[model samples]
Target: MPRRFWGIRRLLRMPVTEAGDQYSIWVGLIYIFNLIVGTGALTLPAAFARAGWGLSTISLVFLAFMSFMNATYVIETMACANAVYKWKRIQSIKRDSVQDHDDHESDEPSRPFNDMEEPLVCGASIPSRYYSLDRRVELGEMANLFLNKTGRTMFYCTLCVYLYGDLSIYSAAVAKSVMDVVCSTIPANMTNVTDWDALPCFNSSSADPEAYTRMGCYRVALVTFAAAIGPFVFFNVQKTKYLQLFTTGMRWLAFTIMISIAIHLLIGSGAQSRPPAFDITGTPTLFGACVYSFMCHHSLPGLISPIRGKSRLGLHIALDYALISVFYLLLAFTGAFAFAHLNDLYTLNFIPTDNDNLFVKIIEYFLTLFPVFTLSTSYPIIAITLRNNLQSLFLDMTRLESYNFFLRKLLFPVVAVAPPLIVTYFLEDIGILIEFTGSYAGTGIQYLIPTFLVLCARRYCTTLLGLGVVNQYKSPFSNIAWAVFVLLWSFICVVLVSVNIIQKKS
Candidate 1:
């Protein structure tokens, strides 16, 4: 009824969008939260244990900030890509850029809903001069727009590597979780279990881990993991609404149980308090693990695109990062103190003893099987997404539109799932797998690609927009200096990791 009250309400309400396009900001934030807390988190306690609490804390906080910066750059580039497309659309007098809200294709420019994404709408009549946002310009399309063939190839290769590593790790984690749960019981003391001791049958880590890989309960578990998940690859992997709901519930429950137990142990005699202030030798592995854990940059488009009102979008992302950083610190710190022998999988440390109360045993069983079910569901979703990415990498989408069934049905899916499955069949050790994946591919995807894309996007935007068209969704760190900073950091990380690997081999 009052104009002042109405103004305040508008500010508080989510930015207005078409009714069909609207989703609560909370909904989008939850999706991002889930993405942040995945299988990589299971390894953090071990990483912290190795690197020491102080080093791990500092590295994680700094890496989280870097990740947030690059994510903004990705979004800025999306807007830039859309701006370039819109500029071309006006020049050609081509397909009405505003006609179809959904078809913000790779080569095309589309308008942000209500121009809400623009930093400042000048009320200028010329369409190309105004700010724009395009949700459809995903990371792959951004590379294609800004990068040469060599760069695009490098990006996709690294992306595929990360995806393959993800699937391999997921498969191994699920099998390992299952094997650990079914094949052995926790001792009466609830002491932490070592990989050697947890092994149902195998022995000698110095021996080739795969020498008897086909024998015993791990083999059965691996087969079961494959049997249960492998078939989903051949079909379209649509997101299951209710299944996600169930998994979300399971995730929060598992998290609560874990941190609760960790804190419980820390408050009692179980806390060992043995971490060094810092461990320089372990920093390389810590670097890789931190990079791997903060990996939401590659998937930012899909997560940010669906939010109803993106008003103060940057704040939302910052808030997400803040919450994630705090949560990771809590888990890592509590875990570092709770178990004297922290294994790579934090859940392994929480196995219930024969003397524990019924409640604690239930918690232990839940923790043991947590990764089994979580990673199992996630494996197929990731495999199918990778299959689609692989197809896009090699084939033109226009050609695939009218193509025959053979390439679409048989070849793509097999090519996608086979490598990771094969890796899982042989490589059972997740620690090495995570390190290798995170060090090389993880750095490339998280840093190099985004940094290079934003630099190109900034240059291309100036040339295309003639320096007058403002982009409202520009990154706060939209400077060449910041880009160079990211590049230098990534380069140093690679050099260090390479040296570390060489020394180990020597």
Candidate 2:
């Protein structure tokens, strides 16, 4: 019953506005930033080290994969937009027909046909009425209605962007928790270490003279739980326009993030140690990181609406994909070339000691702090999304003003503190957990969702809605081929993660 709650209700009732529409651009930019900076910055170097530094080759493959994925997003966006446009047109026509029928019923009861359907009675359709009255009234009504709807859409879209952004922030928090553990255990140098083969990959290796193995595990578990909260809440919440915006933003953000990660890989300094061919699992930790890096496709659909209007979005998607591929390939090849003979996964074992290297040190420190900032920003958004979802179920729920205050001032800080504190307790080898989660959850959400949505839209919506005629000709088989490509890669991710987990457990 509070004014804020009523405002929410009013938002739901109103249409999207131009001002709201403008926010979409910001949402798009942030989406890109979060995706790039979140986990990609921290994990890509490791992944490259694991891939044996076949950077250019791997980059090409990644680029190709993204290109296919981008194609699907384009198709899905156009299809959904066209469907919405057609639906709106049909509704308008129906409304006009109903109004005409009602007017005729009252004025000329015996008329067999409505005035809207009747042929214009020759010259009787006067210039005064035809040119001014009816046309002006109808146009004005439509203009007003459209403006109102636009405002509502913008509000909902902004809300969705906030929610998705929180998800990205949570990912960053997970990384921070891992880095905290890693930094705490590993020594400044492991130059004298010779028995690298016997080192514990998941715990502290000889590299970490003061390894806190037990502490790291506990921290990993706590951060995992904290990170899980956002997605859990998202799934439980009823889908709204805001939710849609979140989803779309996620997709575009993932694309942009991939590009940024790739760029960093090409230009970023090399790590000092070489990755082992096999860890406990047949694949190296770096490989796991790469797989994880690509796992964020689930968030792409949210961008579909905004990108549907112009072909520019498609071009943007392509460019980003191409760049990411190049970046990854460089990481893979350079990492391998730099340290193929070494047994360690991290290139720079001196990171802990070389605090004087301002650039690397700054990035490392920032990575540690980022999660704190991101988590703080994210918590309130998640709370609000959860609150909105639960409002109907809890009819007598606390007022929005009260809930907002509690969430912002109390719940957020508490939730934020819980992870870092819990992680502080057994904080060694936390990076593995982060890698595993990224590979499993991130890949599923980032790549799989867009691929599936696009394929599904092409298959069902294309034929059902006659989209083929409007767009260029592409066979159903061709569409299915694209889907199969995505499905295959997604399956690889599953296999990669599953095998890694099984190996780790054993």
Candidate 3:
């Protein structure tokens, strides 16, 4: 029993260390590659088709958006660093006050939630457990802590948004890809000659409808078991090391594969075809998928952090943003041009269904494999968040040390899996889920959080100018301008989420 307990402790307490430089670069590259190859490439053609936009126009617009998101990451990282400093200062002030109290006074600080031992509202008033500076130093010393906890906390929170966004986008593409493959296998004459509504597969009311059953089952299995679990487990076990290796591979692979995909797409092939001008439903789904694809900015901080001295992280972030923008623009243009009118909003379906076309088959296979990888990568992030939340609640409420081990191991996984699974059952379509989740939840976390954090930090900048709170800076106009831009984007996201939900309900 003692040995088993020690083994569990070892598993949970594994420390994450920085990877070597070469591997770290690869990790960043792979992270970007996943964004480009995973689903974005598959979906862009369809999305542009629905938009009725020219290839050039679509390329330009997407590139501009990518650039903006990358820039936002720079601002956010700066804000997070500042927040850590502010939090430390606040802690210092509290400590100083406690130390200066009269000798006769009780050592305990006054509890804000309670007065003279009388409970204000509840059955038992909980006493606050604010830590002293000595305790803070001890905790910091215990871990090989370099980055402040506050910054780490923010980084992890952003990581959750990234993983969830990936899941939502990849799942949608997988569903569409499955449908395309199954439809291709069927005889055209049978589909046409039969009374379409009366056919078992086509009839919406059938016991096991083809579109809803076969494709849907495969999607759910891949998403729940493969994409969610695979990455989650890998990251939990390996963390930064896994990131380093993956990023390094991705950087070179992204440049090579992106060029190849572009060339193949430009020269017409069996898998590629032009899509229709406007399918309201299809266009929205495509847009949703694309938005989620761009949510890769969360990892920008990790990329920048390793570089020593003077805002190098910001420069790296800016460079990555520019590179990603170019990649997306090329993808959107080539894909749109390849499939002129027959564009399916989901890009995975654009690949040729034939088993013989090597490039097409390779891409198709990767599309199939992506869900498993995405889910696996995402699981660790969910576990970490769940563990943190549970720990916070336990410390605040129960204050019991005896059950900490059991709670950390047994409860965390259950909490992590249950909610997403239950939500998955109600959401039949991956496109809708991606659209709704990205526009509402992912957008706020990705765009708004960074902007807000940046604004908070910039408030203290010594160069003062202008009338209102927003306009008081050396770069007053730029600050206010960016703030307004973020606000507008956030508003649009809210509207998109609401409209999607309503459409789904109807």
Using TM-score as the measure, which candidate wins? 1
Compared to the true structure, candidate 2 yields what TM-score?
A: 0.51
lDDT of 3 by residue, 332-379 (tens): 656565554544443333345657879767766554444334434433
Query: Ten-residue segment with the worst summed lDDT in candidate 2?
Result: 128-137
Candidate 3, superposed: residue stretches over 4 Å from native: 1-41, 52-220, 223-240, 243-290, 297-310, 341-347, 350-364, 367-403, 407-410, 422-428, 457-478, 492-506
Predicted candidate 1 versus true structure: per-residue lDDT over 1-506, tens digit per residue: 21212322233232323455545677667666666678778778888888888889999999999999988888888778766655554443323422332354344343433344332223334343234442345577777789899999888888888888888888877877777766445335644334443443433454655444323566678888788778877864333334545676887788778888788887877777678879988887677677878886765665566566665788998998998788788888888888878887788777656855887688888988888756765666567667766766766643576767888877988887777778776667666667678788888988998899989988887776566566678899987899999999999889877876776678
Give a tens-digit lDDT track for model 2, residues 336-393: 4444243232223223345677765655444344334434333433443423322312
Clashes found in each candidate (C-alpha, N, C closer than 3 A) = 1, 57, 36
Q: What TM-score, over all chains together, does every model reach?
A: 0.78, 0.51, 0.57
Ranking by TM-score: 1, 3, 2
Which candidate, 1 or 3, would have the higher TM-score against the true structure?
Answer: 1
Model 2, position 321, has a per-residue lDDT of 54
